[model samples]
Target: MVSLPEELQAREAAARQRVEELQAEAAELAVRLERARAALSRLEITRETVMEVLADLSAAEVEAHDAPDPRETPAPHGIGVMAVPPWREGLVAGVLPDVYRDIVEIVADAPGPLQAKQIVPRIGLEATTAKIEGTRGKLKRLVERGWLDEDTPGRFTLARHEGDAGHVNSR
Candidate 1:
């Protein structure tokens, strides 16, 4: 039979051991969390670098190509290679790639400004964080190119060009 003092000592030891185990588990989880954060940072950097490279390539391609006849309707740009062009008179959303055209059409059709998260599902993409961020980038690019307006930060709407109220819908 164990004495009361021995039983208390044993219980204390077990509790200490359990605390140590919990500490070890917490340390491991912290390490894993740090690794995941680093990986996410690296992926974001890689994505930005790729987008820059693609934009540069698109610009080079546009410069190298011979100018098309002004009288002829321009062909729709290919997917994954086209840069958002600056909006101009007679420039319609049809000349943009499918994703960009859809974005423009969605904004144009919306009653008011829309957030990137709201646009994500409408663009047929899952409303994940990555997709929302990517869509936000595209929306920012459109605003830069004069295709869209960011009246309030993070909210987007079609750019209102004089005499081109129906241009976005022309696509």
Candidate 2:
């Protein structure tokens, strides 16, 4: 027959081994959890970028083309394929009066005044009343301030980023 003390010792050893195995698994799981969190953070940033782009496009709806709807309704495609206006990305970022500083950052970061609807979620709108004209008014003011020169009636582009003091030195 097996001795009682030896049997108990073996059982205790088995339990200890099981604990070590569980500890190793826990450490690995911790690593995986950290990796997943990092991936999620990156995805949030991407989502925000996409939202920003979409918001810009929505805000610039005034420049919509006269093209007839290809479909009765637009189908939902995957990411990065949304219909955004290429022309009015500048207006999306902000107009000159309100967004001159912001525009400088966007211009410096981007290749040009791109269809930057990518920044919509990043630049979320706050609650405002009908009297409160935020970015839109700033853009109009910028045209008046000569911070932006009008490419067309609604479309305005920055005259110069710096040293202009919101006035056009020359036409």
Candidate 3:
């Protein structure tokens, strides 16, 4: 029979080897995670660009044919904000996709800063963790673009318009 001490040493070596393998796997995963995050950031920027182009086209169309709705609240720079619900179309409607604009409108109209969970029901999206995370990502982008403000981590409110220093709750 093999010696007990020799068997224990072999097992210890095997365990150490497993630990080293796991550490290597963890390092690989960390690199992959960074790559994924970078790709996502690029995608967000592309989406923002596409949205801006669409908004410009829409604004041109409006200026060419449609008379301004006196009932609609006009933005300071003439960027139209479309209605989210009770609010009139102004800036959010002009620049963002329906979902992103809705998110901004929800936060803009909220009595206080709102978390993703709190926003899901009002926005009528199904409450999934992925959906909530997507909402969080959009909110972060809006903050980066100066459309919304992160009141705290994972909580959002309307951003103050740079030109609207006196305008109350301009989104």
Which one wins on lDDT? 1
| Residue-by-residue lDDT tens digits, candidate 3, 1-171 | 889999999999999999999999999999999999999999999889878976886567556655555335433333334322222234334435567767877776788999988888788989899889888887777777667778688888887755543233333
Q: Candidate 2: deviation at residue 59, Å? A: 2.1
- lDDT measured at residue 116 in model 3 versus the true structure, 0 to 100: 89
**What is the C-alpha local distance difference test score of candidate 1?**
0.85
lDDT (Cα, tens digit) per residue for candidate 2, span 1-171: 899999999999999999999999999999999999999999999999989987786666555677434223332345565422222222222222223445434433543442223322224554344223454454455456444455665444655544443222111
The runs of at least 3 residues in candidate 1 whose Cα sits more than 4 Å from the true structure, single-residue gaps closed, are: 1-82
Instruction: Give the residue spans of candidate 3 off by over 4 A.
Output: 1-92, 162-171
Q: What is the lDDT of residue 26 in candidate 1?
A: 100
Q: For candidate 1, write residues 1-171 as lDDT tens digits.
A: 999999999999999999999999999999999999999999999889889988897677557646653224544455554456667677788777678889999999999999999999999999999999999999999999899999999999999999988767674
- Model 3 earns a TM-score of 0.44
Model 3, C-alpha of 115: deviation from truth (Å): 0.5
* Model 2 vs. true fold: TM: 0.39
Residue 35 Cα positional deviation in candidate 3, in Å, after optimal superposition = 20
